[model samples]
Target chain A: MHISPTPQDFLDQSLLLIQARPKTTRITTTYSTTSPSLRAKKTALWLAKKGKPTPPTTTTISPPTPTTAPTTPQQHTAHLTLKTYDPVSGTTIQFVTREIRDVGRLVGVLGRAARGMGGVKTQPDTVMSDAPVPTPTPTPTPNQAVLHVAEADVPRVGSPAPTAARIGTPGPGGEKQQQQHQQQAGGSGGAQGKGKKKKGKK
Target chain B: MHQQLLSNEEFFQKLGLLFATTTKQELGSVFLTQKRLTPYDQNPEKSDTKPQEDTLADLALAETPGPVLVRATNGASKQNRDTKKIKFSTLIEPDAVDAFYVRYAEVCKSGMTALKKKNRRRKNKKKASKATKTEGASA
Candidate 1:
């Protein structure tokens, strides 16, 4: 029999899959790009706002450093344009983020946007209506744990084959288990009754 | 217990479910786009030569969210461009998405695995060399 994984397994795998993939240097959204000059102006303004006062160094300047470090695109800060649909606003919002290393945060942001639109945000109480299934393991991780949490940020209606197989198998296996329980119950009851009769005879 | 790694099919299957759930809630269609930079022409002197953007792939999860609808020029057999405007929706046909996911995962996983293997080999080599050097010095 092929062992099927639970939903937890799928969630863990998804996290690993995203984490294992190399961090993207740039991710472009369907949203239009802002003008380069406009972007440069904004950056300049930001830098100017955060600039530290420095002493005049024209007279006391040191010689220029001989070595220039080569900087790669990865070394350069990554700018990502993330587009998310806000259900409450009924519009797609596009924003830029320099922190693109964590996939969990990315998904959480998107999930929040989706949920704001009244999207399903909870795992269904019952995955399979027909079967008597065990309670879903209470996810110990907090909602803020983002990557590991089992919050239905991305609520799914149906599962893939693994869960499907488990759901389907219980139908046949469940009947066999019931039969075994009935037989065991009958045997134990007969044995108890016989013991009681012998005690009465004694 | 052997860990169950998410296979390409399973990954896509989960993605498909997510797409469906998102769309069913009346969210806007989700899309996966692939683009490649067009190579600049060697002879820049010709003013008439125009650089073009090469769109390798453009697929959108339909509003109804079944199989993905593939664009005509999906970097495949270019000869049969006029095949009834064949819609490559994942709802109608899941195999295309499955195949694409498999190939994409293989390419990405191979790159990651190769890098890891190279690092391991280098570490082993360094340890071996250090051991030999220590032995020689001791002798």
Candidate 2:
């Protein structure tokens, strides 16, 4: 027997479907060259026709609803992707952009309504199965020896120990440095004077 | 319009004359002969000796011989009331007359910058001299 549906039943269903629509879509073909404002205005216009009060605006434009999709900002995103969202029409927006991670998160929240043979309760494991496995973190072995070595390695920290061989009038650091320089100059001159007389003189 | 209240064009012209004078001139005769303006003046009592103070009708005939549009221009002073000049133009059209004003403003700005630099140099020299004097005194 063919069953007739009531008008209330049809309207309620339509409203439900409209509410379920996703808000944005991605296009794989990159159009980053185009103005983002224009694309957003166009999307806002499309949404406005679907009973939204106003279309999206370019400069700090308010979204029709709290869950409005944010336009892709700067940074190279997934290319050659197409995502279409229609919150009012209940369209499942396709996203070709690599911001797929966001879509996966949404899906995670609202999992498949029915699954298995006779609609079994969704297990946490099933929902997590689609999620990317996080890389296991290795136990950080703090090198106690390395910490000591690093503390010892700071060149500025070990600066207090100036050799007696480095003392003289300085602009603060001059005393330590001038003595070292004078000793080096004296030693070098003695070596050179001895060599010059013995070797080149003959 | 003047001493006669509405018929003395001579006196009205004299009023305009006093207004245009370079030096402030007093018209004791006009104020003294003029009857104090009052509602009773319009009662036809006429004070028997005088009529009334200057009304809209009288002043219109006073300031202007014919059709005169009262306008304030040339930054008319409020303290110097009882006289006004007429202006009929937006005069400062950006495209037409403002270019000279803009250029003049730019010149003024450049002059200001030069003056500031000169002042700064003078200040630096003064400070240096003061510093030298202090150092010599200390020594």
Which predicted model would earn the best TM-score?
1
DockQ of 1: 0.03
Candidate 2 predicts chain B with a TM-score of 0.23
Q: Global lDDT of each model? A: 0.35, 0.32
TM-score against truth, every candidate: 0.22, 0.13
Query: Residue B133 lDDT in model 2?
Result: 75
lDDT of 2 at A21: 21
Over the stretch A1-202, how does candidate 1's per-residue lDDT look in tens digits?
1111332333333222222221111111321223334555577777678894433435543322111112111111223344323221233334443332323344343332222121122345574776776889665665557755454455555844456556787698798999999999999999999999999999
Error of 2 at B90 (Å): 7.1
**Chain B TM-score, one value per candidate, order as shown:** 0.25, 0.23
Residue B101 shift from truth in candidate 1, angstroms: 3.8
Backbone clashes in model 1, listed as residue pairs: A87-A117, B66-B91, B67-B89, B67-B90, B67-B91, B68-B89, B68-B90
Q: Top lDDT: which candidate number?
A: 1
Report the Cα lDDT for residue A164, model 1: 57
